[model samples]
Target: MKLKICLGLLMLTLGGCSSLGVEPWQKQHFAREDMALNHEKLDLSLDDHIYFSKEGSSGGRAFAGGGCGCN
Candidate 1:
């Protein structure tokens, strides 16, 4: 009986978190250009290209070394 009550309380607590997310209509707000995670896509790509080229390695955004000591 005690275990059943604890499980019910836990279920109710978990169910309360379901109301915390965004609704369907609110999605459109996030889809706007101003809400983008990366506003300057092209510029960022160009910068990355320049940086990688100067680095002289095909390393990515990780802790990849430059032209030397990349292994």
Candidate 2:
């Protein structure tokens, strides 16, 4: 029936997702500098400082105010 076919297809799709991540031995390769989110660390830090100063808030701090510029 169509229900059985859909269930089998769903199961197959879900099963395929289990092999999607990096293995233990592959972690070292992924941790290299070339795989970093911000290749220019200084530039990224400067940008963050500028944003925080312009918004007048230090993000993720233990303060009592919102820092996302929505207020």
Residues 1-71 of candidate 2: C-alpha lDDT, one tens digit per residue: 99999999999988998868887987997789977876777876666666666676464522334344543
Error of 2 at 14 (Å): 20
Off by over 4 Å in 1: 1-20, 56-71
Stretches off by above 4 angstroms in model 2 are 1-21, 37-39, 56-71
Q: Give the deviation of candidate 2 from the true structure as CA RMSD.
A: 9.3
Residues 1-71 of candidate 1 have per-residue lDDT tens digits of 99999999999988997867798887997889977867776876667666766666554644443444322
List of clashing residue pairs for candidate 1: none
Model 1: ten consecutive residues of lowest lDDT:
62-71
Return the top candidate by TM-score.
Answer: 1
Cα RMSD (angstroms) for every candidate in the order listed: 10.3, 9.3
